[model samples]
Structures are given as structure tokens and as C-alpha cells.
Target: MEKCRFHEVKVSAPSKVILFGEHAVVYGMTAVAASLDLRTRMRIKPHKSRILVNFPDVGLKESWSPEQLKTLFQHKPNTEILDVNYVYLDLIHNFLKTESSDLRMASVICFLYLYSLIMDEVGIVPMEILVESEIPLGAGLGSSAALSVCLSAGLIGVLHQVQGYEKSIFEYTSSSIQKEVCGFAFLSEKILHGTPSGIDNSISTYGGMCRFEKGNLEPVRLERNLRILLINTNTFRNTKDLVERVGEKRVKYPDIVKPILESIHAISEQFLTSIQEYNQDLNEKKFYKILEDLMDTNQSLLTGLGVSHPTLDDVCRTLKKLGIVGKLTGAGGGGFALAVLPPSISGKTVLVAKDLLETKGYTCYQADIGVNGYVIEVVK
Candidate 1:
């Protein structure tokens, strides 16, 4: 029998958008979201008694032997394992053993946690991982979640193939795998954002636009082609700090914020139902109206929650003035803003919007609805 020389697993992680109820979702309010084409990719390979992790785009590289990993895990005092960077060492140490200061370590732990649990059943082997992604980090795009999911799937695939086990892909489909992957992804998100709604991973795994209510995901259908402009402020916002700050406002302005949140929930339900019924009459005019209402509602609620930063407000105002419907995506404070433009607008409207945003020092990209999520490509 030919010995298995090399095995590889490739996976893509997707970006996301919040159509309605951004901050309110944290308080049990409903939110609508979709996955974007922007994605991260990861590949894994086995080495002789060694593991190498590389991020070529970022110029990061790390390698260690299995014995070194075992020694580190064994906690043999004064043992000089490989002289890896303290940051990388801390990651492996905490992930394989304890929770520590490194976010990447926490992510690795989540991946390994699921890997150890699920791999034996599927029969997988340990392998080196090379992760590369086009999704911009800290852009409210769920790049971290993509990384975690790709890792989990790659590890699981290795275990299955190496152990001579078999599981129908259909059997692992749906939220079971999603829930498992999210569990790991959220750990990393916690280290990054303090608190994440897990919406990013949820949509990225499931694909399609969805309305999440009380932890249940209901996919929504689009009636027409919707053009969205994603504006990147190039600012990184800590999700945890933003969540805490919003929490403070909830306590401070419960009366004012509560009703707004309730209203958003109602709108989201209506939006979901409308899409489910396949209302083709839902043209650009109706879509614009709905988006406008959602934008105004979201801005007010975010302002009440005190999470709206100056850049966010400016983008919203700019979109409104230009007669385009838009709102800030994700936890606000800072990150990307999304605008819904009318289809009838001049072809130059896109260029005009881009110029206007660029003039204001914001990066812009035209995004389309209905992009694929979490695709698997097999390579021999």
C-alpha cells in the first residue's frame, strides 16, 4: 500500500453584514444578517515530528517539534523547550493546557478542544497549519471566526482520514457542526472583542441572509438584487469595550432604548416574513424604504446605547444626504458602514459615493448580496 505522503484541507471564511438591530441583538432583540464573499483560507500539512504555522501575507512564521509540544504540555519544570517567541509559546501553552493572555492561543485551544473531542471519533492526525486570508482584520467582517472555523474543519478532516473513520458530510451539516465551530470561534472573539454576539460565525457557516431570534437562525430570501456599499473607516474597535459601553447606556436609558429595540424586533420579523413569501413586488423603491427605516432606527438605537462614534454618524449622514440608504455595521463605535443604493441611481452614483467616502478618508467597496459562504474545495 502506498503510504499517505501528504494530506491537505482548504476552507474559506466569510464576511458579514447586519441589516437590522445591531446593538439590540445583544439584549435579546432580533437581528438580520448575511455573509459576504470576503473570506479567509487555511491549509494544513503533516511534518516529521514537527509542526509549522505560517502566515505568509503577514510575514509571521513559527515551528516546533512534537516532543517540544509534549514537554510544554507535561509541565516539566526548567525544561528548555524550543525557544519560540513568548507570545507563540504562551499561545500553545494556554491552548493545550490553560487559558492565558494570547488571543491566538485561546483560538487554538478552542480548535484543539473540539479537535480532541471530535477527531478520535473521525480518526484524524495532527498537522501543520498555514493560514492566509483576504478578509481585512478588525473590519467588522468576522475574519477571526473564519480562521477558527477553517482550523476546526481542517483538524476534523485530518482526524477522520488518518483514523480510517467515515462520516457523511450530510450528517455533520447544519447547526451541530456550526454550534461546535462557534463555540471555538467565540472563545477567540471574547479575547478580541470581550463579548461577541456569535452572529458572524453563525451566518458565515450557514450562508444566506438570516433573522436570528432567541438563538434560532431563520434564513431570509432576497426578492431583488440589492447593491451595498461597504465603507471602511480603517479603525479597529474592541467589541468587548463597545458591548460594555452599550450595557452602561442600557442601564442609563432603559426607558428610551427599550422601545426602540422592541420596534426593531418587529421590523426584523416583518422583513423576514416578507422575504419568505417571495414578494417579487419588493422592488428597489420598497427595499430603499425598508432600508431607510432600518437605518434611522438603528442610528437612533445606537446613539441611545452610546455606541455610535463620530465616523459612524458622519457616514450615515453622508449616505442620507446623497439619497442613499445606509447604516453602520456591527458593534459601531468604529469599523465598517454599509449603504444601500437605489438601483435607478446613475452608474456614477457608485463612483460618486466612492469619491465622497474616499474624500472623507474612508475606504469603500461595492458589495453584492447573495455571496457563497464557507465553501470547501478539494485538491489532490
Candidate 2:
């Protein structure tokens, strides 16, 4: 084990699911979402010259020099960097116009951008980071957002402790850290998805369930915990392409899509209200019904928008057979399917459901609800 030369810090960020409103959100519809326990975690260590990247779970590792990273960013102008609003895109562009691989370049640009503004208050330099994530990539679980939040919070935490900016970790709440992480996550998400509605990253960063309106995020309170099971179709969905397809549909079939969008918006409100009131009695029946309605709405709307993939349909059909209400999450097409497990469903039943899905080559996990967004742990 090459005597791991770096001290490590661990940070975890949550995954998200849109309970209601999908294709319609772009058309100004409201969406309800909750965070899942699936998380991305990163370990950072100080390094002199080399920036080492590792994804142990997938058996991938790479290293790059700072100069090479800068050049890489220059070549790929579409990369995203995070920092205070004061040092925005132009500053990053100027910095990147220098050499590197896509991943190294983009990661470094984002790391540096975050370090410059966040660490300037503390003062630190290049550190090698190894990131490991359990969250499935490109599965509409907000894995990228979780990664971004983890990186930003980890860097800021190290800088804060080193520079004496903060004395105690107890000073900041997880929710507070989530807010800061959201800023960087939002920036990174934009780089991935041209014009994301910001709901995915927001819910992933904050955890719990929320009602997202045009300009605000309202956290919903549930009386009893909700259990969700995520089934991965082992397929990737390109959010940007899906967004574009939805846009085209809006232009070509406004008459047909508009009503669906309006209905989604209304249902989203009811969903939020239901969660907030903790109506557990009606929740089992009503909640699943609402979820089914939302799924139907999403499938119909996404089908019209031409973003449904065969794999996604297969997973949905499999879940239906298992008696679980589920739908394709995020921009849809192909990715993961999220299913709501009724309280009446037993753990043994869930196992059977998982086995059936796996028999069909679908990967499934019992997702956690109300997970904490982001956290920084110091290992000295």
C-alpha cells in the first residue's frame, strides 16, 4: 500500500429523486423532491506537485501536474469552476488557458476555483484527493452534484482548520454546510446540464423532502419516515440531450403537453401538502396513488418529448410486476428508476422485489430518506 502519504478527510453528499414534476418543470411547473442516502465521498491529502485522482471502487486512478491541469481546462472551455461570485467565469477562463486530461483538468479547475475564494480566507495550496462514491454515475441520483458538494466542503474544511479561520467543527451545522455546498454543486451541475432547473442538486444537498417553486426551496415535514427503493437499469442518461428534447416538444406540441404540465404542477402542490401534514393514515393509499399519477404523467410527457429509453421502460415494467410504484427520475430517457415502497410491504417482500429485478439485470438498492446533505470529517 505505497504507505498512503496523505492525511484524509471524508465528506458525504446525498442523492435525490423528483417525486413529482419532470418534463413539465422546464415549462415552469413545480416539482417535489427528496434526498436519498446514496452518497459520494472524497478523501483529500496534501501533495507537493502531483494531483492524484483515484476511484478505488471502479479501479481507476490518474495523476496530473498543475500546469497540465490548467492546459486541459483551456482546451475544454466548457468545464465548470466554483468560487465566490466575485471571481467568476472570466477569471476561470484566464486561469485555465494554460495544459491536461478532461477529468483532471475539470476537477482541478473546480478545486482551484473553490480554493481561491474559500481558501483565500484561510490560505492553502494544491492537495491530492481520492474520491470514492457509492452513488451510481449517470443514474439520475445527483451523483455529480454530490461529488461537487463533497469536494467543495472538504477543501473548505481543511482550509478553515489550517488557517485558524474556525476553531471548532461544532460551529457549523450540517444544513449550513449544505447551503455552501449547494453553490458549488449548482455551478458544477450547470457545466453538466446546460440549464438545470436546480431542483436535483438542491434536494441532494439539503436532504429531506422539499417543494421547489420558481424562486424558493421549501422543506417538507413528514410525520413518518418514507422508504424508497432505487432500481438502476445500468444505463446512462444524458441530461442535456433530454432537456433539449423536452424543449423541442414544448415548441412542437404545446397544445398536447401544456395540460399535462399544468396537472403536474397541481399534483406537486398536493404531494407537498400531504407530506407536510404527516397524514400517515391517508399516506399509504394516497401517497402511492400520487406517486403512480406522477409516474404516468412523467412517462406520457417524456414519451411525447421523445426521451424515453427502452431500458427505462423495462425497469418500470419490472417494478410494476413487483407491486411497487416507480418512475424514471431526472430528465429521464435512461438512468435509474425510483420506487416508493408501501408500509405494507415487508423487508422480505423488498428482498424478493430486488431479486426479481436483479434476475432481469437491474441493480437495486434500498435508498435512505432524510439523509444529511454534506459533512466534513478531519483525520489528523
Please give each candidate's TM-score. Answer: 0.79, 0.79
TM-score of 2: 0.79
Task: Point out where model 2 deviates above 4 Å.
Answer: 1-8, 46-51, 57-105, 166-170, 174-178, 191-195, 279-307
CA displacement after TM-score superposition, residue 175 of candidate 2 (Å): 6.6
lDDT per residue (tens digit) for residues 12-127 in model 1: 76777787777678777788888776777887776765566777656656666655555444432221221123454454565456556554454454443344344434323446
Candidate 1 has an lDDT of 0.66
Task: Tell me how many clashing residue pairs each candidate has.
Answer: 7, 5
Error of 1 at 98 (Å): 11
Which window of ten consecutive residues has the lowest lDDT sum in model 2?
75-84
lDDT of 2: 0.68
**What lDDT score is found at residue 360 in candidate 1?**
92
Tens digit of per-residue lDDT, candidate 2, span 135-159: 8765676777777777767876666
- Taking all chains together, the TM-score of candidate 1 against the true structure is 0.79
